[model samples]
Structure formats: C-alpha cells, structure tokens
Target: MFEQEYESFWKAQVRNASGQRLEMLQRDLTGTKKLLEAVLLPVLGSLDDLILEYEMLSVSGMKIYAVVCLPRLRTVFEEDSFVTHAEKITRDRFSFERVRARSVAILGYTYFPYSRDELEKKASFCQRNLFELIGRVGNVEGTGMNQLPVYEREVLRFAVYNRKPFQLKDVCEWLQLRKEACRQVVRELEFKGLVNAVGGSATRCHKFMISEKAVALLHRS
Candidate 1:
C-alpha cells in the first residue's frame, strides 16, 4: 500500500480595537463551534488516530487543531470517501460554499471576528500568522510530495508559483538541464498525472502546466 500525507492549516483571524477584544471574540465561539459542528466533526472524528486542540491566537483569536492518523496517511486528493463525506458536511452546512473536505494529519482552523470586507483584505497576513503559529505542517522530505522526486517537485513548485503554463525551454533554463533531460522529467510528471501539456499544436507540443490535483496537493505545503 502507498503512503501519502495531507497537511494544511486553515486560519480565521480577528482584528479590531485595542480593548476587551477577548470577551467580544469569545462570544463568537458559539457560532464558530456551530460551524465546526457543521464543519469538522463527522469526517475528522471518524478516523481513530486523531487529536484536536485549541490555542489562544490572540486576545481575540483562537486556533483549533485536529490531527488524525500520524494519525492516518492516504493518497493525496484521491481519498474519495473522506472527500465525499467531508465535502457534503461543508456543502450541506454552508450551501455551495468554498469549504470542502479540508482534511489533514495536522488540520487547523482559526476563529476570527472579522466581517467579509475586512476578511478579504487580510487573508494573506492571516494565513501567514497561522503558518508561523503552527510551523510548516507538510514535511516535504518526509512525504516525497505525492511521491514525486526532487526534480519533479521543484518543477511542479515552479509551475505552481509561476501560475501559468510554460514551454519546455522555460523549465530547461530554470532547472538548468539540457533540453532532453528536461523533457524526460516533464514526461514523467505528466505520466504520473501531475502535469499537463497545453498551448501547442498536435505535432509541435512544447508547453507544460501543473494539474489541479497537484495544485491542491501542494497548495498547503
């Protein structure tokens, strides 16, 4: 059996005035747990290897962590039972909401007291703080990035960060490999269904793009 680890921490942050923030924010917990009851339990609790903890993120913010299977490891993005069951909880609870099947060996979500407008403005800062608080959960060396080799992972990382499809010449120069070796690695990635070819004629194909599956698999990392 293949072993794969899923790791992603989700954070909800709170930002407001300087006084009595904790009392105000703690009140939000009731709703938060309502969301978690709607969001976390059924899927996470099912796994026998699981740990759930709460952290004080601020006078106003609290962080929740859930660990399952160390707890449990399964193929990245293809665990349909977990995906289907967990996503249904989110969907039924929130109705076409973006929350879906957010499972991880070290799963964490934060509670923030922010309105939609304020939240949109500070998404990155909030996520950065959560990563800092939890440290990086995905162990790249330990997991092998969905079983990719070093070269493939680097190329995939490049594609993800670049956010676009690129030609073979791009990876060749970036990875500093000869054209032939670059093509080989890209082909292997494509064979694993992790990369795709786009923006080329039938006989003159040359561009490579990262797959959505790989995007979800590595986005947390």
Candidate 2:
C-alpha cells in the first residue's frame, strides 16, 4: 500500500526504452553502476547475482531493461554479446559452471540465433530478477540491530513479505499474540533499532523497515 510511488517508478523504468523515458533514465541514471551490486548482493547469492546480471543485459538486436537503474547495470555493462549469449543459454541449458566460465567479462558475446520467443523469455527472466532484487534491498537488515526476540523477528519478516507496512493488529494476527504483548515486543525491538513504528494508535500503520546498521549486523552473522 505505501509503495505505490515505488511501483509506479518501477513500471515507468520498464516502459519501452525510448523518447522521454530513455532520456530521463540516461540523465538520471547514468554513471550509477555500483547501485546494482548494492541492491543485488543482499537478496541474491554470489552465483545468482552473476546469472541475473548476465541475463538482464542487451546485445545488438536484442535489448534489456529493469524496474530500476540499479538492476539494469548488467545490461549496460554487457553489449551485443549478451543478446547472443541469451540465445545460446536459453536453448542449450548450459551448466551454471559453464555459464560462469564463459560469461566472465562484464559483457561478453557468444553467437546464437535469435527468435521472438527468446526475446520474451529473456525479458521475463530479467524482470523476475529485478523484482526479487528489489525485495531483498527493501528488507535488508543492518548491523547494529541483531538481537531481536523471536516474535519481533517474525513481525519484521511478515512486514517485509507483505511488501507493505505492518500495523499492531496485523502483527498480532500474525503472531497470534495479544495486542499489548505485540506492542511491548515491537517497542523493545524499536529501542534496539531492529524495527520502526509510525503513527499514533494501534491502528496506525507501521512500516518495519530494516536499517543499514542491521544489514551490517546480518553480514557479520
């Protein structure tokens, strides 16, 4: 519910890359390559990151796009070769190791014939990676707030899974705990910087976002 603007931004980014859309992204998103790694590393394991990037880039006749500039780096880094590789990779069912071995450069090209179906398949694969990557970034845990209670951890997990803010009632319903108990748990969690609460009442919408500090903590763990 609260991420309507973000969803709109994501859709606009995926619109056919031309005119104002292309120009808007180039001006705003240029030189923003590192953002992709930052957004991807949290959700995707190292191998997944490599495959996701390789699948999302464009080469020659085929092109690539993402929900945001961050995930689009794979496309930008790769050129026509990505298109070629996409064709081969889709048809041959290559091993992950082979894909990794062959597609080492930021963008490398391999030759394969293209079909309309391949284009759609490539786009679908890339889109799934983008959405998964975004979800990982949004719910990332920071370093300082690692010591949450089991119930509180569940609450945060539920919030992120739903992709919206959590209210007291929602948390209570999820954990099957009393409202007061959930509130106390949430309060303790907030004090530790593991979760956030906004608004004034039990019905107040609370967005349980993870902080960078918590992400660092998770990394250490």
Candidate 3:
C-alpha cells in the first residue's frame, strides 16, 4: 500500500512544464508532491528500501557522485567526508569522479526493517549503484559540445524572464539538451552571473531564479 502510494506520488510529482515560470513551477512541484503523498505512499507500502545518490556525469563521461540520506539521515555526510571503499565501487561502477562535495538529497526513504544496519546497507547500495541506476532509469548524459546552440543566451533569457527557481533539468528541457549538456551551460552561466544553482547537486533540481544582472547587461548591450 505504501509502495503504491509512493509510486503514485513520484509520478504525480513529475509535473512537466515549459516556458520557465516560477509560480507555475512552484505550483507544479506542490501539486506533484501532493500527488506523491496521496497516491504513492498508499500504493507502494514502503518508499524506504533504497537510498538516493546523485552523480553528475559530465559531457566527457566524467562522473561526480553524492550519497543522500533522506528524512533524518540528512546530516550523515555533513560531519563526515562520507567516503568509503564503496566510493571506489562508485567510481569503478559509474566511471566518474565521486564528488561527495556537491551531493544533494532527492527523495529518499527506508524499508520496513528500518534498522541502522539496514539503512547503512541501503546507503552503501546507493554509493555503488547510483550511476548504474540512473542509466537504467533513462536519464541520459550528453557532452557540452552537444548542448543546444545559443544555450548560454537561452539560459540568461530564461533566468531574466522567469525570475523564479528552476532545476537543471528544467533548463535542459527548455533547451532540449541532456542534463550533462545543461550543466555545462549552467556552469558558464554561473561564471557569468547569468544564473545560479541554489543548492548542491543533490538538490540540483531545486533552483531559484537570478537574472536581474544578466537582464541589465543585456539592456546595456
């Protein structure tokens, strides 16, 4: 029942939108979350079997991984560097750098036997299988060179016009590039102060809009 609910919640939360508006996005996320709780939890019976880790596999196929301990496990990595032999597994399995520094927590929960040992094992599972899972889940990575033409300009435009929070995936969908390509553009935009990512890669999806500076520069130009 909980598993089913979680699945419903997950699906409901994936509110796809375009044109990059903040209020609309907020509402979208809110709706998505509500949908998750209402539909997903009751259906899934448990959302607590796996840990979520985010990896930034660059356009060059270089990966940066971060483990996320959800709910109360938030601070697991705060005091600790959160590196382990599993870190090696992450690197080897994913073929990318394990960038624990920028990891962010997406959604995470533990299974019924929610013991510390179970949770740690789940964490270890994420530390190892995150990259692989991402691949299995249809999240593709592309190179900077493959990014949409005029992407930096588009990012600047989106930021200036939207004046709200956004995720890297939002930019990717807006620009029609993969997350890796989107990150490349976002890096350039950040350097130029055209846009910024509020949290680390774990919450890479959580973005606040910042385009006033870029808008001013565009007017000047």
RMSD of each: 14.7, 12.3, 19.0
What Cα-based lDDT does every candidate model obtain? Answer: 0.44, 0.43, 0.41
Task: For candidate 3, write residues 41-152 as lDDT tens digits.
Answer: 2222234421223233444444432232223222222112123334344646443322333232222322111123323345433322321221122111221211324677
Better of 2 and 3 by TM-score: 2
Candidate 2 lDDT, 1-221, residue by residue in tens: 31353345434444645654465454433112223333333333222222212233333323343223122222222222343445556544455424433443335432222233333345444433443333343333442223556676566555545644566787789899998998887777678776665656677645555443433333232
Cα lDDT of model 1 by residue, 1-221, tens digit: 00111111212223321234434443433323332232222223222232222222322233322211122232111111233345455645453222322322224333222223222455444333322322233234343374667778778767755656888888887799999999899889889888887877877776878785664454233
Model 2 TM-score is: 0.41
What's the distance in Å from true for residue 110, model 1? 13
* Model 2 regions lying over 4 Å from their true place: 1-38, 41-84, 88-146, 201-210
Point to the candidate with the largest TM-score: 1
The better-scoring model by TM-score among 1 and 3 is 1
After superposing candidate 3 on the true structure, give the runs of residues whose Cα lies further than 4 Å from its correct spot.
1-149, 200-205
How far out, in Å, is residue 212 in model 3?
Answer: 2.8
